[model samples]
Target: MDPLQAAVLQQFFEYPFEIDQTYQQGLAGILANNPSNTVLLNTRVFYFNRLTGSSITVADVLAYKEQSASASESVPPSNSAANDSKEQPNVLTFAQLQELIESGRLDEIPNNKTISGELNSAPPSQSAVSVRRKPWETSNDSSNIMES
Candidate 1:
């Protein structure tokens, strides 16, 4: 199973009987109308069947959590190194810098002097495009297109 599923199952296994009952009831209520192929439904069904005061083995849960934690810890160092190499100082794109200059809003660009130098050195193809407005600006229109 995936780490997230394992984590959730681990949590469910560790919960007190009363808390588990409450959680099961809440899950049942949520899935009362539609009960098909859901994780919550599946978990509820499993725990319900095994609720006859039987002790469950949590070795798998503990081992899975430890393995996942170790794997995650090992992975971040390499990812952080790659991210450090890729990191660059924040700078406005050529188009935005130009727009700010034309609209007399140059002050809006943070570290403008540094950004301007970088933008001037970069090719025209690297410029950022302005955002376009959506066709439907407001949701108050009462007319239905299906009526006509």
Candidate 2:
């Protein structure tokens, strides 16, 4: 597909594109060498799911955005701050980390040295469950299985 068509279709669909490190590095090098040229790269594209197969208008999207903004605003500031502090660690691949950095969400990058380590650090430990139970198998004592 032509770049123009891809640009147009980006508004409605999340199409696959070259996001590999080598391609990005090459693009960056080209841009660095030619500062006069304007490069428009779409790193992320969001498309709403059509569960009901219903047509969606721009107004619908706008209304949904407005509603979400208002809802977030209704959340208490203290609660928001708490949420930020207690944010769960995100396990991300190198490519994903690069994408986050490029998208300007550096804070989302996990800094938990205990969970993950630097490139030179040892590999992450494997997680093993203390108890392994089959889905079809049940405990002999069924008293606590159904509680009021």
The TM-score, computed over Cα atoms with residue i paired to residue i, of candidate 1 is 0.20
For each candidate in turn, the TM-score is 0.20, 0.18
| Clashes (N, CA, C under 3 Å) per candidate | 0, 0
Candidate 1: segments with Cα more than 4 A from true spot = 1-86, 113-148
Write down the lDDT of every candidate, Cα atoms only: 0.53, 0.45
Q: Write the per-residue lDDT of candidate 2 for residues 1-148, one digit (tens) a residue.
A: 3455334434433322233344444444444434321131221121222322334445444454355457678766577456533422234666887898899887786542334555756878888857788786677666456542
**Model 1 agreement with the true structure over 89-145: per-residue lDDT tens digits:** 234556877898899997797544634444466656865887675775434443354
Question: Which residue pairs does candidate 1 place in steric collision?
Answer: none
Residue 79 error, candidate 1, Å: 4.9
By TM-score, the best candidate is 1
lDDT score for residue 43 of model 2: 17
